[model samples]
Target: MQSQDVAPRPTPASDPVVDVEQAEAALVEHYPRLVRIAYLVLPPGLGRGRRVMTAHALAQRALPRGRAASPVIPAQANGRDGDPGYAFVRLRVLRAALEAGGKRRGLPKRSQLPPLLPQVWGLKLFPRSGGADELALDQQLSALSGPARAAYVLRGLEKLPDGDVRRILTEAGAADADAALRAADRVPARYELLSSPEFDACSLQARPTDLMRRRQHTKAALAAAVAIAVCGALVALPGDGWGPDGAAAPVYAQNPAAEAALDPGRLVRVTGTAWESAARTDFSAWPARGDLVDDDGLLRRALAVWARPGEKVRLSFTPGTQTGGPAGPPQLLYAGTVDNARVVILYDGLRIARYAEPKDGTAGAALDFARVDGASGAEAAAIVLDRADGNVRYLTAPWVKKAAERDLMKPGAGAMDLTVTDGITSPLASPATRAGACTSWNVLQLTDDTGTHVLSDLGELVPARLTTGRPAKEKDATGSQALHAWAPYACSLGAVRSQGVRSVNAWQFAEQELPDGSGTGDWACTRAETWRGDGSRTLAQFHTPGGAYGAVVAKAEGGPACGPRDPHVLAGVLWKSEGGHWYLLAAGSRDTASIRATGGISGSAQGHVLAVRAKEGAQAELEGTLEDGRSISGLR
Candidate 1:
């Protein structure tokens, strides 16, 4: 039922009419509280930065445009009780905030976009991170509908009674105020948390953008502006008039090389069978396969944007990937319509540039770049075609004969066949989009002439290859033993999202027999290698016998502890046995000759593994000696 079906509560026959000045007074007096309410009521999907800005914008715009009649419903007991001015401004803010979050049939309202006046160009502002309790509350609120969130905020934050909340929600355009109130009741009564810094948009932490990258962009913009001015002067001198290129930056210079790079005809297109006869198989050999490959206008716009993206374009680059124009004409990998956007993939020798625009027009275009300089074999097997609604579609290599989806957490469940049309696989659930506890991870498994290989989406243009075995001798994670070995640590992949991860390898390091005669437990280390050759993450996971999942005992970022360079890992966990006995179980790689523990608990062992009886909740430090006499500390 629509909110209009519910009539607002009746007020006194004579109520004070509120003018713009009175509403402004109430807004200024309760600015912080009102902004907090708006922040809590705004949609969480807009991200913290955007939500903070939108909340302030809505609160600031709460005052009436001109003198107006006060609503029949009176204000609640929120300090400004019975004040018609406060009630009027509060209703205005609530309506606009709800409208901003609600879906509409046409173009978005001004409230949904970034505010024109209050903007921080070189810095990002957001609320400070809170503890787990705040995070849980935020997640719960995020799951609620926009109207439900507003109801909860009104009831908890404004301390409004049920009748007042109903009236406010109805006036704020909730489709069903009763349903929204019912939905809000499901949330735990954590009213005190409503005033915490976690939801306060007035108090925010600011972080500057990448200074070096910003400087580079500034230099490029200045150079482009100068070139555009010269080109304008030349055009004014009178020759042929140049027309506008849709959604692309103006031509920066009139040089042969630069002009060729932007020419649609100059884009390199590999034949369908090129990979079959090529000496080396990589993205360079993949044939362009998309419906828009011959669309000159689209190709020209894509090429032009890659050369010099306009200010309006949403540009993103993988870590360490240079966001600069190509040196020469780039190879065209694919150009087609994916969902609502037309996508074009171009690859230079060092990087891959993906340009996408709306199918209807080029108004909201985006360009993304990723480094793929030395990718080959399975590493170059798939490129992300599109990501929408927590799902991702992939453009597989031409050599791939079959595509399937496998749940890494359930290695024995087998794989589900996926339809492949023109080298594009059907959309699969992406692990990168998952939040909270990870119960399952879906990975793409592609079968080629050689063997099957698994790849995972890490929120990048390219999916990361998965491998198993010893560090240097890692093989494809397709074998039964390898799959089982990786099953326990599959959820650990969440730690490497958006890190420009190139590949991930899982290696079983050591196993320890339980002291209480329980089954043996396994120890494994998972490492994520990035395309930039650094910032790898290593996790030492412990999988107890019969446990459904592994526990990460230790983790380190940008270290060689669990990598090929230093292929030894030592970690300990306080595990409770079925008999209710506590033990400190420590295990090192096979190469470790001795292990010792100190600090809170003391223990020593001759072999690579050790199990010591210890008290619960005890802390300790571990050190190990390898057979080569090199000393090493435990993974932290």
Candidate 2:
């Protein structure tokens, strides 16, 4: 279980030690977030010196396994940058800190646990100026046990859903995710401190303000002007979608009432200035935006999406028909949520073949730079992202390599023209334009079974250069899937080729060395009644000497999987830990179903070593031994 320091590598390019450098960089980038989480979990009462050192050590120990458990933070959360990945790792590190000692027992008694304050978590939801004393907060928190402390901090402060909180507590060495949830719910009136308004209710209905939009940005005026588009009367496009009399009308939502229903599944149209957003630096408070990319490349912006708790929103991206152009083949058209700050990105990996068939080394019409035939080729494109940063600045192509020059609006008013090619008419513009006024185009076009609807301010989609490789596999029709939304054992995650067998995302280990030579052993204990029920399931996650964890599940109520009641064997759980998280040493779950039959259960992970303990309910019972000579079963 001992860790050996890696030998130093001088240079990344000269030495070419990519793996080592990458690992080191990941640890560095995530260290701060990890420390913050560790501090929350570390038992209080230690001086500053011990508290800081312990959290850092725990974070370091967790780095490797953390990486293994979840290699990539899923791009679906639309959270602040790296929040998902760090959130995943934070739980593991906290759990390791809780289960550090050789001895495992009841939730740290109030007398044994560290100080915690409800206000610390409350500020995350609603900030105020009370500034409660550290000592007073500590005294208030001292009344709570370790599990309660964890629940208050994680579920209450982090704003994670109840389910996510439970999963984290379970992995942190709680007897089970559900039992941990119950214990957390036992925290008196804690939920009231974190309550906010209408968080869970979502309405796609268009309100009056939804029809209003910010007006033209003038060089002379520092601030933006607000304007409302006339909706009562519709004006016909001069050349298209007009009646014979050349009359046009403003379009309205096909079913505004359907959206007003406030159902989770119905699609709501977003247009004009209907929705407002905010920005935050760290993914913690107001956790929010992506930087704008110009001809000069990506530039950091002091802005982001500011979403309130329980407000779940997804941007719509539906690609149109492919007209063979002289542009590079499309590699990826992704609605980004990670790394790039949750912006839409389309990477064209220069796949020339995906365009229409070519002729004489030219993509023929697809690449016809000189287009008279309305053909297709590798055409240039642009994106316009509007962030609510006091000013209305859009994320668009940086023509002339100058971010400032990507001005979406010229003085006066006119549609912002996106010139696809030098002489070609701007590819994406409003159907009509004022002689001197700016014509703004809404980029998102939503096509449902009923009809096609347009969303304003989502950003315009045009061709762009894509250098990165496309996703290895396309996302399923169901939409962005959670990396670990369901327990890896509960259901499959995606078309991830590496899914199912063992979850290898990110993890870190806390090694606990076992006595030498006595590696193999048997537990000597009596068998308890093998009571069965669908009432609840008890699962135990055991930590390896190296800080990695493996789990075992028993479909019974009010009983521990490992303790002193029934000597339960890990019938289908894995017995090995790799890269800091438990891995299946062999095909145990997929093996014969008879392995868990009513008779004596088979198998053991005794060699890895475990310190399983139980927290008694209000009515404490005699902790009993199991048939296994060494294993114990009870509530953890």
Specify the highest-lDDT model's number: 1
Per-residue lDDT value at 388 in model 2: 21
Q: Give the clashing residue pairs of candidate 1, or none.
A: none
lDDT of 1 by residue, 49-114 (tens): 888888888998887566543211111112254556677777778888899888866887888777
Give each model a TM-score. 0.66, 0.22
In TM-score terms, candidate 1 sits at 0.66
Q: For residues 579-612, could you state the per-residue lDDT of candidate 2 as single tens digits?
A: 3333222111111121111112222332322322
lDDT against the true structure, per candidate, is 0.80, 0.28
Candidate 2 residues lying further than 4 Å off, grouped into runs, are 1-26, 65-84, 101-130, 176-636
Top candidate on TM-score is: 1
Clashes of each: 0, 69
